[model samples]
Target: MAVTDPVDIRLLAALADLGKTAVHELAAKVGMDPREVAYRLVALSGSGLPLLVGVESDPQGLRAAIAGAPPSWANRPPQQQFPAPQQFAPPSHPVPQQPAPPMPPGPGPQGVPSGPYNVQGAPSGPYTVQGAPSGPYTVQGTPSGRYPGPPPRPQFAPPPVPIDPAVSTWGLPQTASWARGDEPARPAATGKRGKLGEVMETQGLEGEQLSVQLLEVQDPADYLFGAAGYRLEAGERAVVVHTEITNRGSIPFASLPDNYLELLAADGTAIGKAPVSLTSRPPHKIGVKPGETLGGHTVYVLPDATRVVSVRWSPRPEPDERTLTWSIED
Candidate 1:
């Protein structure tokens, strides 16, 4: 209870819930540096607050503790335990302890220190030739090493794929396909095509193969927009176009015809879809499954006197010359 640090209290709570955790694991949970957490744990244990019952020395025991295995020293201290780190020395004076034995220059047993493994090396000791094995290594079974490599990287989950509201379609499984070194090159498209309104299939930029057909056109004086529950104005006439689209290839088609529907006037003017409509399927947001065909209607309202010479059917607005145009005029 004497510990006033909110961070220390949070760390203690984490230790309680987790039983015995490594310094790195505790640091990750509490968002603190491993060194800082280790120092604090040492201080807390030395404070006689019963936060840590005793220091673990056995390699297998420490490993079991880190692995969330039942703690060996839970309610009682170890019968024979190593000493805790010394408390902070006064600013003006230094604290002295027993000096560590000198390590011989030649290689020793298993390339370890001459004496028993000292948790902390001498305050002033020369470097010893202790080569380590390759790959990850753990110290005191605590998962630390002399030349500690980079910290473990975080694993991130992939972003969710957007769903289309038009229809229930199964998305193709994600695949990474690469051409082999000896694979032959695909021949270029000769750009062979037919006039607008003719039933023809083409591949989209995203590799979606689709077959599109502009079936019929009608200009009506009275128009009923069922969705909005409204009718067209007296002077305005509605131009409705019936169309059919099919997903011709293995890839799924997710384009809505409403976005690319355009009405071009005789004098080089463009008109968008009218606010009034009577059709149930507006082709505004629809997806078609492979080998499936869907029919829809798009309506445009224009002045009765305006001469609509053609209906341009492009995959998108601002399309290139390859886009199709149908003669809608009677």
Candidate 2:
């Protein structure tokens, strides 16, 4: 198909996946002009398809236009139902779309960072989180006895820039109740703490807590990292993992797992069992209650300081796990 086809598909997919989206992000993700995304969004919205497009700013003042919620396009054109592509039409009248239930101000389940929720927008202090990053990066194929069709993969699924929810300050969850304090917690490892999954058909629990920190959209490159190292000697050469965990959520979150560190190759390949790196801390489970945080670190000892590649914190429960990643040159 032509390039335009993908844009149409993405517009439909965005609604299907995110529930709602803005025109700029829709355009950016689908490689289309903002006007086009807006145009399609208007059409879809009028046809009873839900979508939201708006402007938001980060802590540093960078602005971003966002959109979410895609409409399904199962039917072909001509015979398919099409709505006017101008104004945003709330789902056809009469059928009456139900209003969202009001959320209470209390400690809720942990989830992810997604919303336009806001508070005073003023930051209180340096907000800290609880655990390490989610599912650590897996090294691409290491040649076994025989090789497969392709090469080893070092895919990078970088987490979204951590966004601190502002709701907590006002005693409400505007963006999410994610245990990670900032990022939404994935159930895969959180072990049933705070999560945001579709429980019911039309209604359920969601991580709708938005902290003022969400206003701070960090530059991916400017992000400071935290790493945990193991089995070290004296001054071999790994950046010390001095970490601090603070609870910025509305509810209490679990602690960093005992096995929260690993020695991976430049491509995130694991070297061995990530030894327990709870240096100078209790040997028990580590945790942070709402409005609290914890900190820990490890001294990295390089076998050959010259052969040193890099280091990082492994995956743990807390959703927005901050980590340290770096490389040493010969």
Candidate 3:
């Protein structure tokens, strides 16, 4: 049967050009898989095409197959390709050497030696020649001409030892052992906490001006939001803190202020504001332009007995240990 498939025809045409090429290489040339190309080649050979004629293990016959001509001289049969061996004539006799031209006379006095003379003309012993090293032969050494090995390595002093940190004044102080009643006193509180409904102006660590006014602190029993599908857990009350912030800085404030607000307990531990309360005005992700006032409320779910004394506000979500805080009391 005739090769009817287009892929088969393309494979046969490519094989005619690149005779006995590897399956992967031919696949890359025709943009097909190697196995698919191999299958198509088998089908085309089984078909009524003389594509294998004049083809050899070597792929050099592709040009002849593509042009519909016989293999070239190199691929022809050995007997018809190369001529018969014939005897060669013996080499001729070597050519005679010509004599070299003589050198001109030296330009020196009759008694003086010149023009690359040997040391035999001089009384040798320990005398050194002008254009040569100071050695018996032309070797690199003292006049005795005995070469020594490389020079000795240099010696370096050891480094000084480092001091211990415990005894060093610049390091941390040693911990003092205290009795049960003699425990170290806690550090005195730094800044005073502000009360509700009080407006305070504070500058952040980044030099941004912020004027905050705490409106109210609401402790609701069973906070519910039917529209956003959120409810307070059992024995958990929602502590909502309402505040208004005015961007008094020269640049616009682009951060979420709610992420920086926290509620601190009596034991110096801080609790983040809860995101479950959806029924609040001015969403937590609040941004304000220069000289513009933006107000928002943040809610937190705390245990019924947990006492939240103050609300802390900072400019960053995760502030460093030395970061400043504005404590607004409830």
Which is better, 1 or 3, measured by TM-score?
3
Q: What overall lDDT goes with each candidate model?
A: 0.57, 0.34, 0.55
Each model's backbone clash number? 0, 57, 0
Q: Taking the tens digit of each residue's C-alpha lDDT, what string does model 1 give over 1-330?
A: 487999899888767645565565556545577778888998998988776643323333233334442445332232223343334633443335655456444233345432333424343332232454332333444323243233443322223334324323323211112112244434432232344467766665456787777776776634344344656666777777778878889877654544466777899788877544464545444567789888888878788888887676555434443355666655
Q: Ten residues in a row with the worst lDDT in model 2? A: 213-222
Better of 2 and 3 by TM-score: 3
Number of the top candidate by TM-score? 3
Q: Write the per-residue lDDT of candidate 3 for residues 131-201, one digit (tens) a residue.
A: 53221222233334333322322322223334323322321111111111234334433343467677777
Q: How many times do residue backbones clash in model 2?
A: 57
Give the Å error, residue 220, model 3: 2.6
Could you give candidate 2's per-residue lDDT for residues 130-238 as a string of tens digits?
A: 2322322333445334322222223222223433343233212223232333344355431111111111111011221111110111111111212222334443333
C-alpha RMSD of each candidate structure in angstroms? 23.9, 31.0, 31.7
Question: Judged by lDDT relative to the true structure, which candidate is superior, 2 or 3?
Answer: 3
CA deviation > 4 Å runs, candidate 3: 1-192, 224-228, 317-330
The TM-score obtained by model 2 is 0.23
Ranking by lDDT: 1, 3, 2
Stretches of model 1 off by over 4 angstroms after superposition: 1-197, 221-228, 279-285
